[model samples]
Target: MRCGTRWARSNHFRSLPQRPDSMSIVLTPQELRSHLERFPRVSLGYYPTPLDHWTQLEKHLNRKGRFYAKREDLSGLAFGGNKVRQLEFLLGDALAVGADVIVHGAAVQSNYCRTLAAASRKLGLDCHLVLSRAYDQPEDQGNFLLDRIAGVSIELIDEPLGAEQEARKRRATERLAAAGRRPYLITYPQSEILGTASFVGAAVEIFDQFQGLPSVPRYVATAAVGATQAGLLLGLRLLGWKGHVLGFSPLNGGEYAIQEAIWSGIRAVAQLLDIEPSLEPNDVHNLADYAGDGYAKVSTAAVDAIKLLAQTEGVFLDPVYTGKAMAGLLDYFQKQKIPPEEDVIFVHTGGNTALFAYHREVLSLL
Candidate 1:
C-alpha cells in the first residue's frame, strides 16, 4: 500500500486545516489526548518523563545551543526503556482480546522481551519468548538473565531471519491454542502499529513540555527501528509541529530501506487515527552511517558516546541503541549538519541494564 494514499480520500481528514506556511500549526495536548483515549491503553510506565537539560554535555562539546534529553530511561518498567510504552498498548490489547498468553521474538538480550515478560507476570498471564542468538552474546546476561529470573517459557533459535522467527512464534502460538490457551503474539511485524500509537501520545507530551522554553527544538533524535521514529514523526505531524525528527539506525539497512519501513509505519498510524498522512518521503530522515560494525556490537564511537554522556551528564546509554544514536547526534553537531544555534532533543529510550552484558567491551574503553 502507498504511504499516504490509504487515508487521502477521507472527507473528514480533508477538512482539517492545512499546515501554515510558517509551519506553526498549533495542536493542543488535550486534543491529541482525546483521540488517544478512544483506544484502550494500560499504564506501563511513568508518564511525562523528565525533559532534562544537558548543560554540562553541551558545554563539553562547546555547542552554542541547548541539548535536552527526554528520559524514557526512568520509565520504571522492569528496567525501563522505550519498549515499556509499546508494551502498554500491546498488553492492553492482549487483555482486551481475551488472550491468556503473550508471545514475542527478539534477540536473547532483548529489552523488549524482558519488559514483556515482566508485564505478563504483573498481569497474571503467561509469556512465551522466541530468542535468537543474532548478537552472538553469552546465553545468560543482561536481559536474558532477567528473562530466566522471570520464569517465562523461552525458545532459542540460531540467528533466524525475520520470516523464520515469525514462523517459530506462529508454531508456538498454535501449540498454546491446541493446549486450550489464547495466545497474543507481540512480534514486531504484526504489533508495531498498536505499539507505535503510544509514541504519538509521547510526541504530544514532548511538545507540551517545551511550550515555555526560550525556543522550541529544531529536531528530535531517537534510535530508529521504525516504530519509535515513525510514531514520533506521525505525532509531530498530527500535532502540526515544525521540528524535524532524525532517526539513527543501529542496524545495517541502508537509508532507503529504513525510510521505507518508517513510511510503512506512518501509513499505519494515519489509518489508525483516520487522518491524512501529512509527511512526504523526504521528511523521514534515517542516518545509517553511524551503525559501525552492526547491531548489538560494540564500537569505539558508541563506547565513547556512552562514556561521554555518563561522565558529563550522569546519563547512561546502552551500546546497542541509544549510544549509537547519540554518536550520530554528536557527529551531526560537529559536522554542522545540525547548526550550532538550533536546540535539539534526544529521546533517551533507556537500555542501561544491557551494559552488564557488554562489561568487558565497555570496561576496555576506560
Candidate 2:
C-alpha cells in the first residue's frame, strides 16, 4: 500500500517500458485514481474534463505550434472552475473529521469562495466565508453574488493579507467552535496539501489525453496559485511527463515566493502519497510579469487575450486568472520563447462566472 510499491504493481507500471531519462516513474489515469483512493475524497467536479485541440486559436495566432486546451472550466460545480477539484479533497477531509462548518478566506469576488459555498451546501455543512478586500469597490457581484445565493454566511474584512486577515479567520473559527460546531478552516499551510492533491489526479487525465496526439506536448501552461500549479507539476513529474509545466502568476507575488509556495505544496503532496519527492526547486517555473495591475485587476493585454480566445475559439476566459495566463501564453509565442514545431497545452482553470464582475472592462476591448 506504499506509494512506490503500489505504483509498481499497477498495469501502467508493468506495461510501459521505462524511459531512459531520469523520469522513470509513470502512472496512468486508472493507476493514479487507485493510489488516490486511499485518501478521503468527496465527489465534486466532473472528472476527465475535455482535452481538445484549439485549432482555431492556433490558426488565429498564426503560430507554428499546435495548441490544446484542457478544459478544467467544465469541471461542473457552482459554475465550474479549478477550485472544485481542490474542494473535493478539502471538503472530504472536513466531513471525514465530523466538521459541521466550513470556513475559508478569499477576495470579495473569489471563485474559490463561490465554489466552496456551493460545495458546503451540497455536503450539508454550514459555510462561512471571510472576504478580504483589495480595492475600494463596494459592489457585490459575480462570484460574490453566487456565494450569497448559496446561503453562506459572509464576513467582509478590509485586510487582504498579513496578520489581520489571519486573525479574523481565526476568530471566526473560534466563534464556531464556541457554539459547539466543528469548523474546518481551509487556508494556506493547512488545506493546501489536500487541495493540491486533487490536481495530481488532473495531471493523470492530461497524460491520458496526450496519448491520442501524434506527438506529446512540449509544454503545459496554467495560472499559478500555488495549489493548482504545484499539484499539476508534481503529478506530471510522477507520471514521468517530459514536457515543461509553466505557471503564470495572476497575483502580485514575486517569483521567488510563488515558487516557494508551489514547492511547499509539492512536498506536501509527496508526503501525502508516501512517495519520494522527484521535483526540484528548478522545476517550479513561474512567470510573474503577466500579473498586470496586481491581483484581480485586469490589464489591457489580459482584456485583449480574453477577447481573442472568445472570438476565435469560442472559449470564455475570466479577466482575473485565465485571461492573464492566456496573455502570458500569447506573449511566449510572440516572443518565440517556445520553439515553432512544439505543441502547447493550456490548462483553462475556469473563471467565466467572474466575468460578470468585469463586464465593463472586458467589453471595452471591443
Candidate 3:
C-alpha cells in the first residue's frame, strides 16, 4: 500500500508518527486476511465512505478550526447508517451461525432496526424488533415508519422511561421460537463486542485513508454507542493513531451505561481481532452536556444547530443523535476547547429521516 505526506492534505487524512508498539497489535495484510479468515462479510455496504469537510458549518460556527465529517450514513444498506457496517459483519455472522431470525430492542426510531430489517431481508432471515413507545406519538415517523414499510415484525411496548425493555425483546424472541422459528437475539449485552469489531474494521480503512497526512488530527468525535466508538478507538490504537477518540452521547443516561458499553466493545475488539492496547474506563469520554432535558428531548440548542447546518451546509441532522452531537461540538468551540489549527473529524452516523418526522419541532425553532 502507498503512504506519504500529501495523502494527509485530504479531509480524511490525519498524520501521525508511527508507534513501535503498533507492530504488536497491528494486522499485516497477511494477518488481516488471517484474522478475518472465518468471518463472512457480504457486500452490504459502501465501504471507504467519503471523509469530507463541513466547511459551511465550520464557517457558521465561526471556529478558528477545521471540521470534517465522515459520511457513514451513506453505508448503503437500506437508507444508510453507521449500523450498516456493523450489520455487514454481524448479519454475516448470523448467517454463518444459521440464525433464521434476527431480533433486537430499541426505541421506535432506531436506525439499527431499520438497517437490520433490510439486511435480514437480503440474507433471507426474518427480522423482529421490540420498540419502547413511551411517548404518546404515532410510530409513522422516521425509522419507525421505515421499519413498518420494511415488513419487519415489531412489538411496541408502551413503557415509561427507565423501564427495562430487554425483557420484552426476550419475550418476543421466545414467541418466535415457540412458533417453530429459529430466532437470534441481535442486541444482547454480549453483542457489543461483535458490534465494536465492525468499527475496528472501519478504523483499519481510516488508517489507510490517512496514510499520507503531515499533521494528524487532534481528536475524532462520533455519536456514542457500545460498538461504534469502542471499535473505532480500539482499531485506531491498533493502527497506531494516538489521537483522542471522543464518544458524544445523544442519550440522557448516566455515564456508566456508555462507559460499560465502551469498555465491553474495546475488550471484544481486542479479543476477537487479537489486538492489544490499554483501554481504561477513565479513557472513555461520554459528553452528556448536550442531552438537554434528556434522551429524545430536543433541546433548543440542538434544534438551532440542526437548522443552522441545514441552512448553511444543506446537511440534515437528526434531533436525537447527530443534532446533539453537533451541539456538543459547537459547545466545545464556544468554550475554546478546540483550537483553530487543530483538525477535528466528526462521524456523521446518519439519521436525517428523523429530521423530517420532527419537522414541526425544528420549524418552531425558526
Name the candidate that leads on lDDT.
1
Measured with C-alpha atoms, the lDDT of residue 141 in candidate 3 is 76
lDDT of each: 0.81, 0.80, 0.73
lDDT of 3: 0.73
Q: Per-residue lDDT tens digits of candidate 2, residues 132-239?
A: 876543356788888888888999888866567767877888888888888877766756677678888888888889889988887999987788888888888787
Instruction: Please provide, for model 3 over 1-366, each residue's C-alpha lDDT reduced to its tens digit, 9 standing for 90 to 100.
Output: 010111111221123222345325555434554555435566689898887778887777777667777888888877788888888776766665566888786778777787888888888888888887876444767788888888989888887433367766667777777888777776544467667777777777776666544556768888785788988888777666778888778767772488787887787556545456766677777777788877777779888878788898787778878888888887887777777678788888887787866777777876
What is candidate 1's lDDT per residue for 1-366, written digit by digit as tens?
Answer: 101112212322345443343232345678777766655678878988889999999899897889999998988989888889888877776776678898878889888889999989988999989999876877768989999999999999996547788788878888888898888766554366766788888898898888868888979999987788988988887787877999999887742377887888778766655567467889999888888988888888999999999899888999889999999999999899999989999999998877998888888886
TM-score, cand. 3: 0.87
Candidate 1, superposed: residue stretches over 4 Å from native? 1-26, 254-256
Give me candidate 1's TM-score against the actual structure: 0.91
TM-score of each: 0.91, 0.90, 0.87
- Every candidate's CA RMSD: 5.3, 6.4, 8.9
By TM-score, highest first, what's the ranking?
Answer: 1, 2, 3
Candidate 3 Cα outliers beyond 4 Å, as residue runs: 1-38, 62-64, 160-164, 212-214, 253-256
